[model samples]
Target: MRATILMYHMIDTPVTPAEVRFCRTRENFRKDMQLIREAGYHVISLKTLLTAIKNNTHIPDNAIVITFDDGLACNYENALPILQEFGYSASFFVVTSKISGFNDFSWDYGFSCRRMLSTSEIIAMAQAGMDIGSHTVNHVILGKAKTQIAIHEIRDSKAMLEDALGHEIPHFAYPFGSWNPTVRDVVMTAGYTGACSTMPWPNRPDTDPYLLRRSEIKGQDAPWQFRLKLHFATNTMPPITEMRQLTRKFLEKTGVISLRKF
Candidate 1:
């Protein structure tokens, strides 16, 4: 059966990094989660995805694998509890280098802040039944880097997580949802079973495992918007990818400086 994985960033709260504008607020996030619950989609972990795809096991008609990028502290503080309450499982692909404390955040936005999850917080989440994977030691756009650098980013990250968690970190995510065929080969060599990309659409049974597509969830999308995004791309390039590329080009042409500030 086909499945969808939703990628999200910050949940609602205040004190966002001056540059991080996509942080979803708690009120809206709560509403979205509620909507998910109402929709009857089973919020599952990546393990379920792997198992179903590999074994062709029977799964619910609508299954979703939820993921949180950057390991935000708010994911532990705000999102985890709600997830537990909802009996929803999610995966957190952590940046091993960012485990120093709760104060260090990603450089994705124009500014930086302490929003990512700490080692202790991550451990707690894992113990509480969340799946952990590698997002990299730091978030790097592997598609743009040299092969050697890409290998280090992809391979070293899984190693780092294994050392920390004392277990295999079998899954991955592209730092920016960016990948090329070379990048995919490196990830496979790094020993990851799968790597989720920011492709943004429903994945079919014939989907590529190494370059698994995911639905990019933003704080701004309502249930209707999510539905449309999940269904827009079927046989060709995903709508989310097309939308992102088009939006990027439009922004570049118009000199909006919205997504480029970071």
Candidate 2:
């Protein structure tokens, strides 16, 4: 019952140095799909994963769930065709307020602001058998935000997305993978069946549905690195990653690196 969930953000060539960590080139994405096929893995939808978790049933071995965050236009324009070619299903966690608009929030994080999916593109993907989930209305970091703000971000985004797609948005992704127990409760109380967190591990039967773990595939990852992450559920040692993150935060806080330029 162990399953690995792969998280992606943008699907295009990196235009800026900052974008490299989150953006994957189209060719690499296709190659990753081919690698999945070669590795004897089964790509499952979020709905399938959630249903199994809810019903306490068996999930296929080597199950991998693909997901994209931020609703970037390249997801529809570049990622979708390759996914269809592989006959695989993926879940997209979109920022509801940014649909059909540019990702202004990314600019604050030093990422090149990019266009987001249009309503038509989202509907088309949903019709084509993809899962559409919420990444919140503004991609707010729920762990640090106030309780009411977290509630609004969780509930309103689901409502907005459901209204747009004319169906229930059953899952959510914590923005920047930030969440606490209170935030997790809000997601469940909002009626979502499951939620994703960037915990960098494969999920097992006992895993919390609201905090399902994911491994991110970065843009600059070599094929071997990708394979390592695919097999190990993480590309780097946890302590090393934590140190790097702490250092980055310290630098940002000390005005050593501006977030917009970091």
Candidate 3:
């Protein structure tokens, strides 16, 4: 009944050095989807997972949920096509204030400013059966903000997104994966059925819906590394795994092994 929730950001080439960690090439995204299919995993929506958590019912052990944060234009321009080709459903968490605008706030974190998804694109995705969730009004870091600011961000973002899509926005992702217990309570009071966090682990029936753990899929991961994360629901390697990777790197660096072999 354990399920892994995979987190992704932009689906395009890195716009800056800071973006390299967050961006995944479209080709790689396709390959990742293909790998998921070949691995016999079932892709489920966030809503389905939340329902299962609520009902305390059993879900497939191989169930995985795909989610994209920030609602970048590439999500519609690139990722959507691949996801549709695979007939997979994903949840998109968007910043309410950035629809149809540039992500100027990214500059504050030293990330390259990129275009956010347009309202039209978001509505189209929702129409196409993608779950549209709320990230926040301004991507405020709820855990660090004042109580009133957190309340405003949590409640207002949901209201704004619902108004846009003409439907309930029942899920949310903590901005910057930042949330304390108070922030969690705010989200609960704001009417979110579930919330996503940056913690890397699989969710179980006993796991808190508001503190749902997600394993981030980074652009730097190799195909094998991606498989490991998918199966293990974590990127943190154990001691033996770390030693093996180090040994492999040393051998490759010393010319005892060829990159082609890997």
TM-score of each: 0.81, 0.89, 0.91
Best lDDT goes to which candidate?
A: 3
Off by over 4 Å in 1: 14-21, 101-108, 230-262
Tens-place lDDT digits, model 1, residues 1-262: 7687878777754454552345677776676678777777677678878777777776775777888887777888988888877788889888777775543444444444665677778778878988888887667788898899889888888887777677788899988787899999999888888889887567666667777877776655665676654445222334567878887788888888666551
Extract clashing residue pairs from model 2.
none
lDDT of 3 at 137: 90
Q: Candidate 3: how large is its RMSD? A: 5.8
Identify the superior model by lDDT, candidate 1 or candidate 2.
2
Error of 1 at 134 (Å): 0.8
Off by over 4 Å in 3: 236-262
Roughly what TM-score does model 1 have, to 2 decimal places?
0.81
Per-residue accuracy of model 2 over 1-262 as CA lDDT, tens digit each? 8889999988899988889999999999999999999999999888888888878899886999999998999999999999999999999999999999999999977887789999999999999999999999999889999999999999999999899889999999999999999999999999999999999888888889999999999998888778767777883534557867887898999989875654
Q: Write down the TM-score for model 3.
A: 0.91
Per-residue lDDT of 1-262 in model 3, one digit per residue for the tens? 8899999999999978888889999999999999999999999989889999999987899999999999999999999999999999999999989999998978876788789999999999999999999998999888899999999889998999898888999999997899999999999988999999999989999999999999899887788878888988894655557878898898899888874574
Q: Rate the local accuracy (lDDT) of all candidates.
A: 0.74, 0.91, 0.92
RMSD in order of candidates: 8.9, 9.5, 5.8
lDDT for residue 8 in candidate 2, whole number 0-100:
96
Better of 1 and 3 by lDDT: 3
